[model samples]
Target: MRKYLFIFKAELMSALQYVANILLHMITYFIVIIIFFYLWNYIYDDPTQLINGYSKTQMIWYVIITEIIWNIVSGRKLCRRICDDVKSGNIAYNMNKPYNYIGYILSSHLGEGIIKSLIYITFGIILGRVFLGAFPTLNVLSIVLVILSLILAVVIDTLFIIFIGLFSLYIEDANPLFWLYSKLILILGTMFPIEFFPEVIQKITTVSPIYVICYGPAKLFVDFNLNNALNIIAFQFIYLAVAFGLCGVLYAKGVKKLNVNGG
Candidate 1:
């Protein structure tokens, strides 16, 4: 645990050296938020109209929160790194390391993303204030719940990515799988709320990564129902356990296969 902390700290410190990159990412996020704000504004011609139980402000903020999660999780490229390691025979070396490779990957990825997520969140709040004139209608407790949910969401997302990356140990590449995953999240989770889709699609999404990874935290933030928050958080824990278990099984099998093949 201590060693992983040191690795995490090292990664965080190293990421600080690339502040310019993250700032560019911030600019991109801000531009996307601005576009969504205008689109929602145009759609809500009548102020009192609620589309799918979300006012224009709530809708835009939902996009903001979802985009933050999407960007933070997507930018890590965990699967690509794993693919590259396998291609370069580096996974063999990594397997022999003193630290758990998955732990190292998760810790370093979190360290890399934390600062960027913070910057994006700060700017996103400022944008919300400027354009929407207020934050989500929430007290400190609700905000805390949203924050906790977001943290768990990030973990679930990272675990999924790691699971996808581990596929490189079996196949030649995993980028295509990640590409499909990203598109699913983008369309089903980030671009709009699940309620915007057909009822059947909504039901499918609830059982998918779309529910826990992007929609759960964003929904809790923009809508803030205590019952919903508790339910989402519980589901997140279940998904986390499932994701971790699947990753462990796949990785163990992959390692065994690698050893047998003497790769």
Candidate 2:
């Protein structure tokens, strides 16, 4: 724990040095939310009309929250990093180190994302309030629940990224798989709420990362439902276990297959 804590702090400080990168990302974030704001507005000429059980305000806020989460917890970068590690022989070298390689990667990714999460979520809320008005009513418990769901969403998203990235051991590249996963989340959840989809797609999304990763936190933030929050968090834990186990199995097998430097 202490060793990984050091790695976490080291990565956090390294990420802090890249302030310009954060600024550039925020610029894109601004453009994205603005685009969606207008698109949704045009879709709902009558702001009061409910499309698939979401009011205009609810729908707009849903997009905002989900986009924020998606950007902060980007799985593509994690997948790429893992692939690079494998290709560059870093994964093999790290295996000889005292620390667990997967733990190191996980800690580093979370640490880097912490600052971005703050900046994005802060600016995201400001943007939402400015353009769409205040968020839906919520008490202290609801706020705590939303925050918890968001954290769960991040961890689960990261685990899935690690799971896909582990395929780097057997495949030439795992990034294409990540591409598919990210695009699914983007079209199915980030750009629009799940309710916007047809009934069949909606049912299918529940099993995919779209439900626990994107829609869960956004839905709770927009419309706090205790039962739904509990259910989402529950599913998140299940995915968490599945992803973690897969990563562990693949990492163990990969290590056994390592032939680094005439080992």
Candidate 3:
């Protein structure tokens, strides 16, 4: 446990060195929300009018929260790192390490995400307020709930991306897989709330990772609801367990295969 904490601290320090890069990404993020602001404004002639149960303010805030979550997790980069590890035979070096690979990755990502989360989340709130007014209902309880949900969401997202990256052992490439996964989440819930979709699709997404990953925290932050908060957090925990289990199983199998093949 202490060793993992060391890894986390090391990564946190390393990430601090890249603060400038993160801020550069924030610039792009600002541009994105601006576009969304204008687009949503045009879609709704009345700012107060609700579409899919979200006023313009709520919708834009939801997107901002989602984008913040996406940028913090940065699943694509993690996936590529894992793929590179496998391709370069670097994973074999870790086989002799005392720490579990999955735990190491999770801890490292959490550390890396901490700084970005602070920056992006802070920027996201200001952007929402400046462009779309403040979050309709901001309270201490709501803030706590949203923070918890976001933590679970990012952990679950990192584990799942690790799972996908582990597939590099079997597939010739995993980037395409990550691309599809990211796109599906974006289309289903990140860019637009599930309510905007047809009932059938909404039901599917509500049960999918997007429910907890992209939609859960954003929804809770946008509109505070105790019932929804409990449900999303509960689902996030379940998904977290599932994702971690999958990574462990895949990592173990991939290692066994490599050993058998005389790597």
Query: CA lDDT, every prediction?
Result: 0.87, 0.86, 0.88
lDDT of 3: 0.88
Candidate order, TM-score descending: 3, 2, 1
Error of 2 at 131 (Å): 0.7
Residue-wise lDDT of candidate 2 within 21-50, one digit each (tens)? 987989888998888888888889797898
User: Which ranges in model 1 have alpha carbons more than 4 Å from their true place?
Assistant: 259-263
Which model is ahead, 2 or 3, in terms of lDDT?
Answer: 3
- Candidate 1 residue-wise lDDT, 137-222, digit = tens: 89999999999999899889998999988888888888899898888988899989999999999999999978998899999988
Candidate 1: C-alpha RMSD to true structure equals: 2.0
Count of clashing residue pairs in every prediction:
0, 0, 0
**Quick one: ranking by lDDT, best first?**
3, 1, 2
Query: Which prediction has more favorable TM-score, 1 or 3?
Result: 3
lDDT of each residue in 156-222, candidate 3, tens digit only: 9888899999888887578899999999988887899999999899899989999999999999988
* Distance from true location, Cα of 149 in model 3, Å: 0.2
How well does candidate 2 match the true structure, expressed as C-alpha RMSD?
Answer: 1.7
Query: Can you list the residue pairs that collide in candidate 3?
Result: none
